[model samples]
Target: MCGIVTAISTDNVVPVLLEGLRKLEYRGYDSAGLAVLHEDSLVRVRSAGRVAELATMAASRHLTGNIGIAHTRWATHGEPSERNAHPHVSAGLAVVHNGIIENYEAIRERLTAKGFVFESETDTETIAHLVRDKLNAGQPLLEAVRLTANELEGAYAIGVISEADPFTAVVARKGSPLLLGVGERGIYAASDTSALLQVTRKVVYLEDGDVAELKLTGYRIFRPDGSPVERTVTVSSLSADAVELGQYRHYMQKEIFEQPQALGNTLEMIAGGNTISPQVFGAHAGDVLGATRRVLIIACGTSFHAGLVARYWLESIAGIPCAVEIASEYRYRVSVADPETLVVVISQSGETADTLAALKHAKQLGMDKTLAICNVPESAIVRETALRFITRAGPEIGVASTKAFTTQLAALALLTLALAKINDRLTADDENTYLTALRHLPVAVTKVLELEPEIEQWAQRFASKQHALFLGRGRHWPIAMEGALKLKEISYIHAESYAAGELKHGPLALVDRDMPVIAVAPADELLEKLKSNLQEVRARGGELYVFADAGSEIPESDGVHILHMPEHYGMLSPVLHVIPLQLLSYHAALVKGTDVDKPRNLAKSVTVE
Candidate 1:
């Protein structure tokens, strides 16, 4: 997962490309590079590490060009080094690529037999050599891009600039994201809308098998067969302020602290308590309740975990039968759908590849009652679905999502309440209690944030541990899974989560004195069973770290540690319990010297399959 940005203009384009890359750095930041078509040669500058290093190198040398393309890479095919940094150039063409090329070895063999030599270890470099070979054979630049796309066999969003066509840039996509920005001065293209937010709000999202030839004067959209197509440009509603990390040490920290306000805004919109009512779902509640026979929640990564939590809410509180599936797995399964089945897709960016494909598949199966819970209002998920629920988390730049995950939970909780009301499953008192608890969540979350100092101290004790086990029961099982995910994602620690009762079946063997276990043991009926599970871990010599509610008497042990939490209602406890685990992971990663914002082999958005 890499970020790509290209600018074609009448004036020098280096500055615009750099600014765009800054906004898109969250996508990938292992290494950075840029290729500019200057006069009759391709000028390239690259460096390892953050975009700031690349900016310094570019400024030291006057890299002036009217057309240029840039990339910030996350290492996939090779190690993070200057040799593997993108803006991979060949004889006459320079290209920046986003997704993986699965057939690169096959193509490389064919090209090597033709006496073509590769200078870099990236799969993207193969495209540049292939385009150069096509151009040498008298094919036009646009035709060369099309032929390359035909030969390629995986996910990719590529931008190519050639000395033969110094005035134009070609772009094509298969499974990854690509967007075209229409500005008054020139045309800009990038992997996501965040890169183009500063220059223009109007954008056209490129579809699979579509290509665009961008020139200084104008741009044309074409199919893979070179047929002209009329593309609809939608105005982006994302504010310029959304991309900035105002007065914060890092975007990750800012996003973690923004949860209170984000949750409050989402609740206010959904419940119509302090702000304008959200028309996203309330307007369609009656129709959704009347027409739907079952509900399906599709997502991946952190969003999938949120869906897991929502499954409980929808089934238990709303009396609705619900199915939660990972999007990639759900897309290939045999499915039957009708007007009676409602598909709900959860995504932060709303551009996740598998989830988007599943949404399209459901629509193809003739399911018209489809809805999206997303943060980006103008994303493909929102544009394709008939109904949309927008999360109020403004912009989550962290690779490991914090605010967005909580807001999704808050939004889904409200959705469950609405469904229960329309379906006559919930009585007036039940609805009032749930709503009141939700309204108090912002304050509860604030109380959780205050536990950071204690969490940091706990993290110091287990920062050197190589593995951890997380346990929860019932509704808290999803919380356990999410806690393990956050720990592994950022800290690079091997962590596993299990239903507390299932530990004895298999996972108990992994327990030892060296292993540390974190259990989400809130004061509920399940607390007694969870205590027995903790004792089992202790009997096996595994260190125990329990997050318990205040006034709960957890048995003391020499190796066990406890962090008492502020008491809250049962359903809302997960919302508070998740906070300390997040901080624990954050501090552990900080101590381990791992990149908390951009973890290895991970991207903020999974636009490619």
Candidate 2:
């Protein structure tokens, strides 16, 4: 996915465009470019690297314009090069685009037959050429953009500017994120609200097939059929200060330590209650969740792991049948969804490509009862669903998620309690008890964070290991899987997680001295079984690394090293157990000299498949 920003102001727009693009750098940072109308002529600058390079080039060229559009690319259709970068210009028209054009080849061939020559290997160039042709044929600027939007297929969030109508900047979106920021100076269009936070707090998020026109005075939006539509402009509650790194080594470390406050904020609405309330979800939450026959959770990456953990909670506590599916895998398969199914979607960025597709797929199957557990309140998932819970985990900059994951778990636990109350499976006393646990969570998490120094030493030991195995049973199995995923994501370690009982089947043979085994041993009923599994690994010449809760009675020995958790959190053990795993992976990646925040081949949001 690429980030696009467009600004039409009274003064020079290059500086504002650059600042907005910098804020959106988290969406993409491979290549950067911008086209500004200077002296009634379009001046386009393209750089083959980060936004800094593009900013430097624009500064050196003295780029100045009252109307401009900017982009930071992730190189989807072509390699990252100056020519392939965005702001593809043709015939006085400039365009910045995100998402893939499914019919790009066909469009290119048609444009080529019209005697228009191509310049770069990007699908975005086709839009520029097509818009140029439209404006050449005497079409208005907004009309040309509307016609072009219908011509191209697949998802796209595009910003288009032309010398013919230099006062207007047009932006449109279909199956991708785009928002309009209403500021005192002018109107701004960007891929995320974060981009406009520095200039404007009021924003209007575009729905699928909505086209907007940004002018110096104001902005106007329309539906796919060219009919004028009204959009609600809401003030963003996101603080720009949260995106700053006050005193952390990296965004990953900062976000990891922010879990307590993030989770507390997420749970604040329902934590002080003596009884669980369905109204916490949304206006129709009670009716929708009350009629739910089964639960289906769709998500990707760390969000998917959170869904897996929710599956156990829903089925065990709420007495409902729950199934978790990887959003990417779920979209391709046939689903026999019931009309009474509650399709819950989880995402941190809320712009995750496959998860959005899967949500649409479920809706297409006539499952109208849906809920989105998301971090961003203005995200597409929140607007698409009838119910939502924004996990106020505040701007997770790290590609490897930390606070976002734990906050989702806390929200899911709330969902579990609310659903249990509806089914009468949970007593009023039980609700108060769970609420108390949630209220105490911030303190509990602070205690867990105290083990970071010890975990860092364990990470130092883990830095040299090439292969690793993680083991947990029942509800903790997903925690083990998440731990392994974090290690592989940042540290580049080859790791896998297996249920403790599954170890004897086949994984025992791979447990040599070269491979270390990490176990999640909570003070639960399954501790004895997990301990026996650890013994199997130890006998096979594998070093055992155990994160055991206090009262688990797991003593450290010569080959088996144990990190004692200060307390056992009963049903909330998974939440506390995951902190050490995060610290371990972060410090391990630090020791291995790997990218801690922006790991290779990974972006913060997966806006494309």
Candidate 3:
């Protein structure tokens, strides 16, 4: 995935483009570049590092223009270098692009034979040349871009600046995210809202296969049929201050602490009721849930773990057959999908590439019932789904998710209750119990945050360990997986999770005195069986680090350590149990002196495969 922005203004657009690139750098920061139309030429400058380097380079070279395109890349087709950087200019056309062009190789060969000289090894470069070639054949700038788009075969959001059109930059999206920001001073297009938050709050989200031309004072959008289209300019509620890391050392920690408020915002709709209303999902939620015969949850990364936990809740509480799959794998494999199945896609950013692909794949299989539980309002997943629940976990800047995961679980719990009501499986008493638990959830998570000091001490112990094994049973198993993922992601430790029952199934051999075994010991029905499985590790001399509920009786002895939860939250225990794991990973990564926010080789949003 890469970040792109196109802007034209009466004021010099260089500073706006540079600031936009800085904000979008979290998408990818391997390289950064921008191309601006100055007088009669496209002046391009690129650097092979963070956006700061690009800014320094441009400053030294005095690169200036009023109309421009910018990009911060996460390399997919080529290495991250100055030559491979974006703003690939050719034949008077300067282009910055996000997403992959799958048909690049074949198109490249055809164009090479046509005597078009190539410079860098990039799928994006091919797009630049294709537009350049079309323009060289006397096509107007907009027509050349339309011709170039018709020749492409893959997901992409492109920004094009032509020397011929000094005041206009064209942008397009197909299976990738793009949006336009309208301002009194100028018009802007970007891969995400963060890039335009400072410039304007009014935005128009572009649909797939849509193209637009941003001009100095206005913009126009066109459908795939070349007909002009109008889009609503929703005033985005996001503020510039929400994205800043105030006192927190890292974005992950800030997000972790934001769980209570984020979750409260997510639960606000259902807070006053005794039972969940399907209206919380969408206006047609009740009709969709009432007809759903089964559910298929698709997601990637931490969102996948949230879906796994939802599987247990849906099957156990709602009496629905639920299955969870990694979106990347699910997209490649053949599967039995029915029209009655509710295909649920979970994502924090709503722009996850593989998850969006899987959502489309399910639709291709004739599954009409779709729901997206996501954080961002105008994300691709939410836009494509028939029904959607927007989680209010605003602006998760950390590469590793914290508040978003907890809020997903909260939304999924509401889904469970709503589905149960639809199936007549929920009793009045049980509904009241769940509603009360949800109302108290924010307070519960607040208390869980209090355990950080104790958990950090445990984290100090884990800093020296090279490997870790995590265990849980039943619904809590997914919590174990999330715990391991957090540890490995930020701490740079080798960690793996196994169902407690599966310890005997070959994974038990990895247990040793030097390796710590972390267990999610909630006082559920599986506690006794999970304890028996833990004995296997204890017998193998594996040091134990158990996050047990207040009453869970998982003892602390010589080699066994027990960090007691303040209370037992029953089905909601996963939300509480995970907080400590997050704290442990955060503190352990701190001790290890690793990059906690931008972990190695990972982007905040995986918008590319």
State TM-scores per candidate: 0.90, 0.97, 0.97
Quote the positional error of residue 378 for candidate 1 in Å.
2.4
Query: CA lDDT, every prediction?
Result: 0.86, 0.90, 0.90
In candidate 2, list every pair of residues with a backbone clash: none
lDDT of 2 at 322: 95
lDDT of 2 by residue, 1-609 (tens): 678899988878899899888877765468899999998889999999878888899989888999999998887888889999889999889999999899999999999999999899999999999998888899999989999999989889999999888789999999888999998888899988888888889999888899988888788899878999999989898889888878999889999999999988998886656777898899889998899878999999899999998898999899999999999999999879799899999999888989999999999999999999999987888888999999989999888889999999999998999899898899878888888888889899999999999999999987989899999998899999999999999999999999999998999989998898999999998999998988898888999899999999988998899999989887788999999999999999999999788777677878888
The superposed Cα distance between candidate 1 and the true structure at residue 524, in angstroms, equals 2.4
Kindly list the per-residue Cα lDDT of model 3 for residues 1-609, writing each as its tens digit: 578988888888889999999888666468899989887687898989888888998889888878899998888878889999998988788999888898999999999999988899999889998998888889988878877898899888999988788877899998778899998889999988989997899999998888898887688888877889998889999999998889999888999999999999999987787777898889999999999989999999899999999999999999999999999999999798789899999998888989999998999999989999999988889988999999999998888899999999999999999999899999999999999998899999999899899888998887999999999998999999999999999999999999999999999999899999999999999999999998999899999999999889877999999988889999888999999999999999999999898787788888788
Rank by lDDT, descending?
A: 3, 2, 1
User: Residue 314 in model 1: shift from native, Å?
Assistant: 1.6
Q: How do these models rank on TM-score, best leading?
A: 3, 2, 1
Clashing pairs in 1: none
Lowest-lDDT window of 10 residues in candidate 3? 22-31
lDDT of candidate 2 at residue 275, scale 0 to 100: 74
Task: Give a tens-digit lDDT track for model 1, residues 267-347.
Answer: 775354522222547476567656776789999988998888888888887788899999999889997676787788999
